[model samples]
Target chain A: MTTANPQTNETVETIHEETVETNHDDHGHHEQPPKGIMRWILTTNHKDIGTLYLWFSLTMFFIGGAMAMVIRAELFEPGLQLVEPHFFNQMTTVHGLIMVFGAVMPAFTGLANWLVPMMIGAPDMALPRMNNWSFWILPFAFLILLSSLFMEGGGPDFGWTFYAPLSTKYSGDSTALFVFAIHIMGISSIMGAINVIVTIFNLRAPGMTWMKMPLFVWTWLVTAFLLIAVMPVLAGAVTMVLTDKFFGTSFFDAAGGGDPVMFQHIFWFFGHPEVYIMILPAFGIVSAIIPAFSRKKLFGYSSMVYAVASIAILSFVVWAHHMFTTGMPKVALLFFMYCTMLIAVPTGVKVFNWVATMWKGSLSFEPPMLFAVAFVVLFTIGGFSGLMLAMTPADFQYHDTYFVVAHFHYVLVTGAIFSIMAAAYYWLPKWTGHMYSMTLAKWHFWCSVISVNVLFFPMHFLGLAGMPRRIPDYNIQFANVNEIVSIGGFAFGLSQLLFLALVIKCCRGGEKAPAKPWDGAEGLEWEIPSPAPYHSFTTPPEVK
Target chain B: MTASTQSNKKLITYLVLGCLGMFGFGFALVPLYDIMCDTLGINGKTATTAQAYDQQVINKSRTIRIEFMAHIQPGMKWDFGPTTNVLEVHPGELVKTAFVAKNNASKRMIAQAIPSISPGLGAKYFHKTECFCFQQQPVDGQSPADFPLVFFVDPQLPKDIHTLTLSYTLYDITEKTLGEALTGPQAQGVTP
Candidate 1:
């Protein structure tokens, strides 16, 4: 741990300045939060809000993972063993909704909340009171969604995509609850995005130029724009589904001059960018981590920025690739196919740059570095499979198959979720002021990496053999592979518990940490103390 | 308010507007999709109404197969199918066909049929001079109703297309029709 930089000394002085300024605030507490539960409820502190988000995401991760366990247990054999078929569908649907909206999106937002202000030398988010509102609304939203399972018809079983006709005409009574829950979630996301954008645009410390800003900040700025732009489109999608089901607006019913396929078009329009939204911040995290562990300045920083921007821009155009089998015109098929493949160029540039940073450098296999390296390799595999699915002719076979399922899990679980785990390990010491048990982290990593592959990898084979997804029962021919995947699924689910334990142990107390826990780490965050001060940089610090 | 606060207020306003605009755009996509499909002859959508045919441009050399299909949407208690299942005709020749629908329910029911043409590229050339799908049909209890269609394949249809399918999916719109009948004209103070 090194704190040799002169900037660190300047930050220590500013901490005192921040304490003086805290007295002027409405809360009237300096370096200490108000007592009890209301401290979390009413507090506008960014770090406190960040903690709430991370814990909420972790809790959702476990709940969603438990639902996944039910799915895998039922599919453990060819016969339906654990739950009914409809219950299985509900598991799959809610699992997807929880993981996407509940776990991944909020986790990224949580990281932004904690790290963005510290990295950019801002005292707090630009809209602090609104930020509190954003965080508070999320739990109520998920509660509405989860509670719908107990309703007469069970929760949404129409899959996370929730294409029309299935979601509208054939759906259950819980459809209204699902729509309302999604609306609330979208509102939370939009407000959170607005807060991020305003903070970055207005609150950067003097001398922190656009080009010099950290990649995490840069990636988040782009992600925030994406959230603002597309979340509303998702709101529009669910609203139409609501109307078509309840109000007879027929926005997606052909009998009323509306096309069900249009629901897919609008959904993927928002959805494709939503995928990038989950991963782009992961890219920023890996970019930050790889350079640190490699003991080198990141290779091609400008190119990394351009690549993220290009990927975001390309996301909007390539949405219809998801609809290749929907009988679109040949021209649309070709257009979407070409546009989807173009995303690979910028994505490729990012992968190569990460490898280049690690090339011929003093690389160490810390927990963070190990996960970052895995993210690069496995995310590329996912990217290649995405390319395969992007081809019009090939997609005709892969559509709705477990191969499609396998592709996304590789990207999301191994790509986005892995980077999140890496970030937790990298900053845990700084966050909790104690190092997590290294042995436990190693065991957690090895178990997850091996089992996740076993879980998702065989699905590609099952799909290639023509097994469909979202079904609890399959032929005896698939029995062996299904068993293996189920075993892997259980193992992967259990491995996450070790992570929870490690976080708790770290928080309770372990090896004390210094100002900078990693020798090669660079940022304004490292310039401050470990367990970053309650209020940092009330008088903004100059970057240069 | 400070200058920064004022600027933040402006940015927030713009972002809120962007969100509202996108919501409007989502609704607008319904019409925009129709217009694009009509102009591009995509999505297997046929013409909204009848189009005229020129007798002089009939292609005598080519014989084309036109297959008709009718389906009753799920939950609709109506028996429906094409009376003339298939036909062989020269391009630009007028063809008359009929579909029969019987209400299985005890009361009269209003239904609408949506028509689609296969080999979507052939859609622009498959002109319906008159079609039952142009308006909703109300069928009496247990009685079969005959709905007629008059159409022609344009002589300008591509040489490669030798066969096409026209399918109609019928949906029960009785509830919607009844609801509209009560509220539509009467709510607007128009007397029948």
Candidate 2:
């Protein structure tokens, strides 16, 4: 409450006044970040919206987790008990959609909105109003998607890929809603990406060079670019599906002279980069966490940045690898195979650099670092599976099977989602001005690590045994693996509740935190006071 | 250099690796592009109604009747999906069927369903079919992928262009792979 400098005091007062006017558009001239529940409904502040996105993402994570439980449950004994085949399919389809869009993506965006301006010493987002709108649109997108499940024919039973004829000729009425919902989500993503792009370009402090910015910021910059480019292609693919289903176009028809295979071509074009869109930022997050805890600069910093971008570029060329079994010619198979395998080169650099950063360093096993270490281990497992799948011949055995499911769940749930959980733990003190319950956080971490592996690993065995995906029921021979997979799924689902409890408990009230919670942490972000101000860096900080 | 300058240098060092990545993928493009085009069947002619259709396998066999007109190729001997058909044949092997495609813009357009009839499980190869006898002939006046109906004779002449009729009752071969091509596996996790 003490301001030694008149200029600093005056600037705060000015920021407060302008914020009040902005509040008129938000909570309508209310003081103090719009206190009541109404604040969430009527707040434009980047920090508030960022918080909203984080919470929403976590909630959806649970919902998606429960669906995964159903999958695991059904697999538990091999007999179809917990849910029906069609509904089981709905669970898989919605589970994939919700976790990817509703949870992980939003969680990262929340972190970015909270961190980017602080890291670069900017006042707020580049386009504040659009940021608010983007956050608001996601809930509606998911609602429409979820509601489609209970619809007469079941929600989007065509698998997340929504292959044509299957989607066009056989899909239920709710597909129209699914198409629209995806449309809105894409709009939200594109606008959100554009805002991030502009903020990074124009609003940095006077001397924060691009190279000087943190790795998290750099990876997100690339991530945002990937978003802008591919979100549109998703929109295009879905639009073609829309017309083909209802409007009578033949974009994916083999009979009307259109090749159904073209559908995979278009979908994966958006899809491949999208997976990178999820992981690139995680690469950035782990890069930040490892260094802060290790008391060392990131190993091979330039190499890390280059590796992240390289992965992004390569994402586009590997799209057709997903379509290898759908009747493609021989040469295209090899090309995708080779291009896909080559992607591992840059990815390998990233993994090596993470380990090298930890080598011989004074590493502390803090909660964030614990999760990061788990991420490196498990995500690597996922990555290795990906490499295996990349072998064109090997993929024949893996594609559309639980093995494919197992691979992505590791990369996504452990790789990306784990990083987001780590980011929350690392920054909670800074955001809440109070240290969270560490005992609870460590509980959440250990539980998630053990449970997540249990949840995803057994599927690999089943998949290798030739169990296909997207089917509601399986033959009885697969009972043992299904049972183990289901038990693992429930354990993983329950573990996430601890994360929610820790986060909520911190937000309510806790022991006061010092501004720089970690001594080794370095960034413009750490320089700011704990519970980062409604507006940090009203005047930008110097780079050095 | 100060630590800051050194760190900045390290960042730049890695960025060059990114450029290497670009070139790396750029190298894979040509061969990958060729593979993508070929496997996707982008180069093969789109199977037209006239191109003789292949026959299907009858497992739990039941007679399913299918009625559609196709432009029969003159020289190519093709079979429909199933086996029962009576062609109104003329002396010159005169090919007869509906060639004009009615564009019903108001409702769904019904393209001619070229029928394919062959042997049951472990039956003879789907070498030819009655309905598939229709071939995609790029007639002098027709549009893209359009083929005129053509029929040939063994030293027999009936080229009057009329009264030649081919008819066949198609059996159901649905849910069966008409045939498996040499395409490899479906690549998983291509999504970014």
Candidate 3:
């Protein structure tokens, strides 16, 4: 690798000498990355780690998507044809775990790793070594999680929420492994988040004041704070689950003065903010993309920052909305209900800002722009369903049904996951110094956009018609829609392979990209050369 | 050390402290949940304090049917049920009921019963004056134990709720109690 890249060696030596002359600091001892796989194993470079995280997330997305395929195949005809009920439960559970932790969260972290420093004109992450450790721990964490499936009793069959009595009193022998895996994932997220926070705060270029920083950086700052605050709470929750399962603790046992409902309270306390952690970065990505495609400055930039912070704060009190059917007192129900509805305000502000940014400008539908536009419309549909679910009395009818499943998949799959796809398309040129095949990317987008709706749209009707979620089979009344859904699911699964091929093609070779790939783009990242240098901003640039 | 490095260290310290503080807050929710439940009178959590039953005035104009339900948690080796499944009583009139529990295991076991009332709005109205669910019951091997519950429906119970289901789920607490006993020096007299 060193022989292949003499330019990188010269750049590193120049940075080292410059660092020595400017300040006697520890960073002056920079070394060349080793040849072969050792470069990845022992690398502390942010771009390398970001690549690792992205690849890991894509691999997990396929794994989780394959599990979704199994579910659709089983539900294809609504009979017990593909797998046993026990195995079906495991598929649903592990699929949720992998997608949320292994795919979406890591993908955002990957984007932050790559973009935050470049956007702020920093040398690297605040703690580059910790960044490597954070990325490395994730593979092992997911390995432990996936390995549990082949265990004697099979992996955790409880839903991803893993409510007690089911997870504690009646879970299989692999609950310990599941708990430990979750703990490690939490550690990884917390460390990654801490690095993002510190880098953004301490490493910004001279003139990149708080307001001048890119919206992505600002949103990630809030997101990192949320992660640092809540990931530890998740650690606490899974620890209690481990003890309740193996040790003689009764934290969730009713007979020993413990209430199972208390478990939901703790989990959702960590869980609700966690949902925002997955989405706020999407907001940042979409905010970045909408303007680039529309040739406009982001509408209401300061308000966007305030809206994200408010949403983060409001996330804490609205968790009980998930438990409206648990029979909380009328007053408590009203309080949570109102608080959940109050979240719509800031969210509305964000949606309006995106629309305002795109209103009547010279809009073009590149693959990234297409995904962002789809996100605005489809995510609003998800938001409307969420609003309906927030009403206490209405939730009594919708709880634990496919309606609930439809609501989340809309936000998660279409909202967060689509934003990730858009970010990849938008940044591929900058990272690879080549433009990806636009034709294949558009095919990937259109196939995904249509089939994904065909897959999840019927779930709303199924839920409204009283089909409960997490079940292996349903009554024959729901058979036809399930068939359509399964077909759509398979098509959607196949479309992602095109994305994989596009990425590989871009990385290998394509049309050489200019320094500024997008005509309307504006950022410090755009100011830098394509395939951003081995060490960025060794001498920080002035933003203004 | 440079000022930037010092400030970075301070920020990291505060963030690490915040993470620890949030972890503690998660555990704090345990007590906070109990306090919330007690104050809201939701989730069928009955009051621990015995109530004074008002026998002076009985609302004979209305009759409410009360149903009893019993469940055994998995891994609990005990046979338990309510002596009476259903009873009709006038509002404000105290009623008494009994449940029989027999240890099916070869070894002595301690069990605790958790009570829940359905149509959860009826929880505050259905006051328990004396209930076996308030304490743990330890039964020797193959012995049967009868525990009684004394409660009354307050006349103020909503007129719409004419029927209520009171269910008790029994769980084995032997291991936990044994651990506590061992630490308290009471295990010397007992054989495992």
Highest-lDDT candidate: 1
| lDDT score of residue A261 within candidate 2 | 58
C-alpha RMSD values across all candidates: 4.1, 12.7, 5.5
Q: In candidate 1 chain A, where is summed lDDT lowest over 10 consecutive residues?
A: A1-10
Write one digit per residue (lDDT tens) for candidate 3, span A133-186.
999999999999999999899999999999997999889989999999999999
**CAPRI docking class of candidate 3:** acceptable
* Candidate number of the best TM-score: 1
> Chain A: TM-score in each candidate?
0.96, 0.95, 0.95
Ranking by DockQ: 1, 3, 2
**Which scores better on TM-score, 1 or 2?**
1
Error of 3 at A439 (Å): 0.6
Per residue, candidate 1 scores C-alpha lDDT tens digits across A1-544 of 1333655445434544444554356566546777889889987888888989999999999999999999999999998777989999999999999999999999999999999998998888878888899999999999999999988989999999998989998889899999999999999999999999988887777678899988999999999999988999899999999989999798999999999988998999999999999999999999999999999999999999999999999999999999988788788999999999999999999999999999998999889998999999999999999999999999999989999999999999999999999999988887888988899999999999999999999999998888999988999999999999999999999999999999999999999889898898999999888888788777777787
Clashing pairs in 3: none
Which prediction has more favorable TM-score, 1 or 3? 1
Error of 3 at A487 (Å): 0.6
DockQ of each: 0.49, 0.04, 0.47
